[model samples]
Target: MLKDKVVVITGASSGIGLLTARLLSEEGAVPILAARSRQKLAEASSGIAGKHEIKVLDVTREDQVKQMINEIIADHGQIDILLNNAGYGQFESIVDMPSEEFGRMMDVNYMGIVRCTKAVLPHMLGRGSGRIVNVASMAGKIGTAKSTAYTATKHAVLGFSNALRQELRGTGVTVSTVNPGPIDTPFFELADPAGGYTSNVKWLMMKPEYVARKIVRFMDSGKEELNLPLKAAAAMRFYQLCPRLADRLTYRMMNKK
Candidate 1:
């Protein structure tokens, strides 16, 4: 179903987005990679098969996002899918995290999706068909210690995606959110500069390709949500049912950083 479809993925320079691009390209989909780093984007796309394009986009900037989408439409004629997979985590207690850093997280992680989606929605609505896949996190589903800003941003993403899904329900544009547990990616190198979080979850982390494959395979399948590692999802569900106990345990485990 993805064959020859024009799919645009933000954060395509690395991690899940890069892996998804490779998989989609293998399925004959035209992948348009968007990221802030042109050198990294070029390097990442070099090994992917089939036709692909890259756009240097910092999703926080409305003008840049608008320009990238416009250029995409001009080149691809239409966009079939948009994957809002650009985000990062900032692991720190609320009191310790800098206000500006927290704000940047909200800007890049939350507003970034909003900007890109708004830029592409009109085109999708005009065409009367499209797919939007948001790469959310398990933190969005259940709060964890040391993720105050990160969790808030992801929660906003989930809320935004859910509301947008309802608004576009009858418009043929489907929205889906993928909530994956900790993935073994360079994300942590930045999110946890001290390596505490990574060390704590290294054994539990899922590979980027694994998560990416699942997303690329089912993104347009009309599914509303995808949660990784049934075990983690089950635990999160339990947490939702018993917030006090579960949250306390999680806090103790992840607060060491």
Candidate 2:
């Protein structure tokens, strides 16, 4: 089903986004790599074998998001998929986190998704067939210490996806969310500069390729949500069912950073 499809993937410069672009290319899909770095996007596309395009986009900017979407539609005639994968996090307690940093995180993580989705929705709705996949995190499902800002952004993403999915029902456009646990990627360099959280959970870290494959599957699965690392998904469900007990246990486990 993905063959010959035009996929627009934000954050396509690296990590799961880049990997998924490669996989989609392998499946004969035309992946449009979108990111803020033109150099990085070029480098990422150079490695893929099949047809692809790269767009310089800063999702935080409404103008850029709108322009990118417009250009994609103009060039491709239609966009079959939109993968909102551009986001970052900084792990810090609320007291220590700078207000500016929190706002920036919100802008890039949550509002970025909003901007991109709003820009692309009109095109998708007109065509009456498109898939919108959002890359949230396990943090969104279960809050932990030192992740107030990051978790809040992801929680907002989940809420947005859920509501948007409902709104898009019967419109032939679907909204899907990918909630993955810690993956081995450069993201932690910024999110955990101290390297404490990475070290503490190194054993549980998943490879970017693993998560990327799951994301590719989700693009056409018609599923609403994809939570990774069976164990983490189970834990999220447990937390929802037993907030008090899970809070004590999860806090002890996640507070090691």
Candidate 3:
């Protein structure tokens, strides 16, 4: 049952992770909020009316990830679910973005998820039960302009989720990926200081609450993957199936904008 389940959520300070934490807490799950900012975590914990824990964790750090998992197991006995939702975007063109910044984007969005997953697996395997819900983006399936680094990182996330799901299949563990479109959250505002926000996302933005509802249901149902905003998912699938046409059409639409 979701009630009392020990769910650890990364990126819980804001956006989708924060929303999910609050929603799950309302549903009776003991949501543990994890992020790099302690103050924000504290504020979020206090604002929420349910029982939850907050931890200052930089997902890109190996030692911190390991320590957090060990600590959670010690306190909670077992981790019922792990939400690898902490991520940032660098919406810079390849020419403008330096190698160091590009690498950091990979470190946070891609390696962050990898490190968090590694830390939780040993504990879950020992108990032979757990769930992992990864927040990927529709960018993973279809590339977007001026977001090469972010897109690549999300694609890596999707690849990792796919492989991990197969490896853990039938082992009393399940992995699911949430591929969401543009969400009307401060995620873009916080991540991109240059206001490099692409024009492509203006019409397609969604609410974090919408995605939170999906996350809760996806966890309960043990869904293999979810491509949210049904129409967007459909279009992306078609793009994957017909890259040439998708490219031409997307380029034309983008040019018109």
The candidate maximizing TM-score is 2
Local distance difference test, per candidate?
A: 0.89, 0.92, 0.87
Tell me the number of clashing residue pairs for each predicted model.
Answer: 0, 0, 0
How high a TM-score does candidate 1 get?
0.96
Compose the digit string of candidate 2's lDDT tens values, residues 187-246. 998999989999999888999999888888888688889999877888899988998999
- For model 2 the local lDDT of residue 254 reads 78
In model 3, the clashing pairs are none
User: What's the TM-score of each model vs. the native?
Assistant: 0.96, 0.98, 0.95
List residue ranges in candidate 1 displaced over 4 A.
Answer: 254-256
Per-prediction CA RMSD (Å):
1.3, 0.9, 1.8
Candidate 1 scores a C-alpha RMSD against the true structure in Å of 1.3
Tell me model 1's lDDT, rounded to 2 decimals. 0.89
lDDT computed for candidate 2: 0.92
Q: What is the Å distance of residue 138 in model 3 from its true position?
A: 0.4
Ranked by TM-score, the better of candidates 1 and 2 is 2
**Which lDDT value does model 2 have at 69?**
93
lDDT of 3 by residue, 1-257 (tens): 69999999999998888889999999999999999998998888887899899989998899999999999999989999999999988676789889898799889998999999999998888889999999999889988677788889999999999999899987888899999977877777755554435345566768779989989988899778899787798898889999989998887554311
